[model samples]
Target: MPISSVEKDLDALTMTIVAEFPVPVRRLWDAYADPRQIEKFWGPPGWPATFARHDMAPGGRSSYYMTGPGGERAGAYWEFLAVEPERSFEVLDGFAGPDGTPDPAMPTTRMTCTFEETGAGARVTTTTSFDSLDDLQKLLEMGMQEGMTAAMGQMDAVVADLASFAAGRAAELQILSDAQVRVSRVIRGPLRSVWDAHHDPALLRRWMLGPDGWTMPVCEVATKVGDSYRFEWEQEGGGGRFGFTGELLESLPPHRAVTTERMVGVEGPGTVNELTLTPVEGGTLLTVVITYPDPQTRDQVLATGMVDGQEMSYARLEAEVLTPA
Candidate 1:
């Protein structure tokens, strides 16, 4: 989607960005001024963020929300630079520790944004300057500046079709494979009810594969220390079913369950699965953690992904726990 005649411009001896958005300068200004709007679009594709403030005036500060791989939040702050209403602004962006204290080793950048009204719409020309050419060269080497540029591009498009962009990510990849499925759901039911449902083979059949077809080789253990089991799984497709042997190494009954599984197939070495159930205000929060030995296995597993096999197991757990009598 690169357009010719990109309206490229530069400032003397410094790196710069020049582009036009669909909206006017003032509208773009508001998007910068409003924290909520900033969160909608900003940063590179696949990278998520949040805006804590948009102090549009001088001496105002802003915070950014950053999430790591497992959805854990990492945040930081930036101090505002020159600010002129709806026209231009600048800022010194840095990496602050979780406590919001600036870490001096990570130098801040000076960013300048100028808005001009073009017939196409308002054009935004953002130029970022470092203290030295060496610094600028370093950032380019680190892929920092280009990342921000792509992020701005993503934001501009997001401003127009938010819902469509979201749907595109959530839509099924539409792949057909004889891969395994793991489904999971959290149920806010009583502990006793969930426990009873789990113990009953009839109720288990409703959510899990009935004992007739699948091997329930694992079961019958105290929900206490050193408890465990094994399972033989056959997928819907015929690529050769796999067997998994593991145990319930630890348990805080009705709270969390720790299980380690070893795969018996050419596909994997083995992986550990951890399930946590924390009682919430009304419902219990269920989490499934799968630690893959290598990135290759992770990628392979995702290629066959639908409802992940572990997630499916959690779904079965939820059904047994929450189904009403």
Candidate 2:
């Protein structure tokens, strides 16, 4: 068991759990920073988790759900209060509805996770403060301690497996739900550069082309929340022309962005794409949570080899735009 101690202070209305790992602090921190890695052990053994959004920055929010053995789900969310990279992070944790809204009936807690170097390796101290003694007792009765212990038990394997989530790997796709999917990649560039590459027309025209024979004829980028952008591509010999248009719904420069995307000439509901970028051990972790109109639409798009095209474009971005000549 990685958990060294679990302490509950009734007077302070807080519970503290300390877990030590046989790895460096950076390794332990990265395991939590990346949604792909953290989701592996965020839930207990039988109840696996899928994170739809995981933005590890102050004022950001993360929403995820755990699936039970019977296929039932329990959703939760974290509103980040502070983030000190590789050191500590604090969040307001609470229950969430299926739509990811906060459950007003459930009690919320303030939790802080601190990382430190230990003689053996590294240690993580997680302290959760409840609003009242009743809240703390209520959670304890709900098997909170047992759930956490079981979840942390699986971290040993995740932290040690570095190759799976290492840099230079191609983009990965995770189906978050019937209508949502998350595409993730570790781009070999700084966070700002990756963010800029998506916005600057010149930078985008250089690498947003998916295949070797394709050329981007139009590259209009949305600069603000209400701005709309369009992009069109064509084959080298002037055949196979297509395009996408979208309106920027939200923009948090260099960290996150949300946009509504649809085919330029298509006549149907569009998809909402939420993109988040975080600095990690190897490079910038880019995550895009896309919400399709429905399961059919989601399947249709994925069936078109969208992920493979995205991988090709990202690889090109690294080799052409981000990389030095």
Against the unseen true structure, what C-alpha lDDT does each candidate score? 0.54, 0.93
Model 2 worst lDDT window (10 residues)? 203-212
In angstroms, the error of model 2 at 264 is 0.6
Question: What TM-score against the true fold does each predicted structure earn?
Answer: 0.45, 0.98
* Candidate 1: tens digits of C-alpha lDDT, residues 1-325: 2111222223343666676667666666655654445665565666666543334445656656666567666556767767776688888877677655776776567778887788876777777677766666666787876666666776565445433222112212211112211222345565455554554544444554532244343344334556555444463454345555566665545544557677655454666654444332234433345556776665576667434543554455555546555
Candidate 2 lDDT for residue 33: 89
Off by over 4 Å in 2: none
Clashing pairs in 2: none
In terms of TM-score, how similar is model 2 to the real structure? 0.98
RMSD of 1: 14.0
Best by lDDT: 2
Candidate 1, lDDT over the whole model: 0.54
Backbone N/Cα/C clashes per model? 12, 0
Report lDDT (Cα) of residue 222, candidate 2. 89
